[model samples]
Target: MKNIYSILFIALGLFSCQQEEITAEDHLISYDIEEVPVTEDYTVGALYVVNNWSSNIEEVPLAGHYLNGDEEAMKQHILWADSAAIDYFIFRYSYPTVNADNDILSAFLNQNTDSLLNFALRYNFAQMNLTKENTLEGQGKKEDFIQSFKDMIPYFDQPTYQKVDGKYVVNIIAANQFYCDSLELVYHELREEMSALGYDLYLTGEQTGWTPPARFEHYYFNALDAVTFTNMFNNAWYDRHVFLPQSLDQHWQYSKDYYMDKEGIELIPTVAPSINPKISNPNASTYIIERDTNFFWSILNVAKKNIGPSRTIIVNSFNDWNFNTQLEPADSYGSSSLQLLRNQTKKN
Candidate 1:
């Protein structure tokens, strides 16, 4: 009877040891589970700056002025943008003299804090030195365009490059200049070549002029992935001498209802602090929109309500001082615009 009891105790001890072994393997199994990669949510308020980095002057006569490509000045500018929740800057890239601007972008990217901010290229092909001889219809121009895309592949592949719907986003300024038939060919060839190189492209056309065949039809012939407006209002409005916020609101509603809702095309809306072309061209008229906090707050609310959270909201510029539309810190406004953007973005 004693031997039987002893044998039963030994069996229970062995079972307990086996249970401990199984528990040890459970943690190892858990560790084998792969962690999911963190990705930015597109539904959030992601702000982009249509940055103008072409300033040559080291200082302006105006207070709070700084050079466009000055590394130290840009560092502060980027810090302010980051604080304002700006996700990216679509640097305006014109041909020939873009090397300086490109260097500025490179400097920004080289910063350790650059992960909080990013940049993409806004190719200003119209301003580029392309003549009729080098247009898409002209010989060798199509190949030239393809080569440009190939050259950009390295930049597009960078970790900080902005992507929409899993494809690198490239905004083309002056899209109307490209012939539709030629553009279609160029689009297809670019897509094919890019795909072959294991990359995807999302081309956006910054279509100016209020007149349109509806939003979807805007890019029907051009074969672009999406369409957006560079300037929301017509030049006629600029000549009117009165810029109404109500009119802007009505235009927003029209775009939201007709273009976005009915046509089902992705729309990226632009919000300018003010428009003062006269600052650059003395003879030009000025259509000033007020820059009070309420001004940006109202526009942001309208965008949120109408456009939803899935699309990017573009600020007209970061540093377009000559045109008087910069959001950079100025001695006049201080950080008022930046504060407004940060506040509005947070509230929305």
Candidate 2:
């Protein structure tokens, strides 16, 4: 009897250990990343809005403390943007629901100061899992999208919501993932619903479809008002151990050339200070792009020339801590990027 009990305990211990190992592996499972070398020279240029990935106060580390919707911290962030002449923020609005951390949106909306900044919603479609099996059918998925839009109707009515051509500007990220045979019908229905509710949406589709330019033109561009790249680099670039500056420049040029002559679709180019996702995801396969203010300025300058002043230029992010692409003040690089942005915007 004693031997039998001992054997059962050992078996349970082994099973628990195996479960733990599986969990760890599951967390690290990501798409295989590829890296390519940079070999081209880039021209220098001016800057656009110095936006950061604005997060819940809890995401930011201030004086060794994490803040969550702290009004003072939120105000300080706005002050930083104001000082840097950042026109507005592209706030990440995760779908299916808005989390409590989004209280920062309310803080921004409620502020009565003259230096208040504007914001537009960037729907994080990837996280929403709208493509999950059976999710696209019936009322569940469509209702979710509708409700998400309804929730933002109040924000859309606010004077500070960013607009383009007199319509509220909204960006859908990973829009390709949402594409299906019936996507056009979904969009049309949603647009009709939104029109009924008195909100005109100026939608921009980011990173749409597998085939660049072609799929985007055939599927997404017709539905969206404009299109843009979120990070301006292909997965091959991110797979490498070291990022080549020339590769980034070449990629930007290719993107610019592809969209420059497109007669009907508008292109909004994105600029980034760096690509350093390893800071948050240790398992991240890509390496950081060696960064300086010049790299950022040159990219913006090229984009401004290619897209022209009429189109808006989106900074990759202001506070995306997960991938370490934030332009916010950090312990290692405090306000350097912001100052660079300020200098460039002032030139404009």
> Candidate 2: where are CA atoms >4 Å away?
1-64, 126-128, 132-135, 138-140, 208-211, 215-218, 233-263
Reference-based lDDT, each prediction: 0.60, 0.60
**Regions of model 1 farther than 4 Å from truth:** 1-64, 95-97, 112-114, 127-135, 213-222, 233-243, 256-264
* lDDT (10s digit) by residue, model 1, range 266-292: 566666666556455556544545456
Q: In TM-score terms, which candidate is top? A: 1
lDDT of 2 by residue, 260-279 (tens): 56645566767777766555
Name the 10 consecutive residues with the lowest summed lDDT in model 2.
Answer: 41-50
Cα deviation of 57 in candidate 1 (Å)? 12
- TM-score of each model, paired residue for residue: 0.73, 0.72
Q: lDDT of candidate 1?
A: 0.60
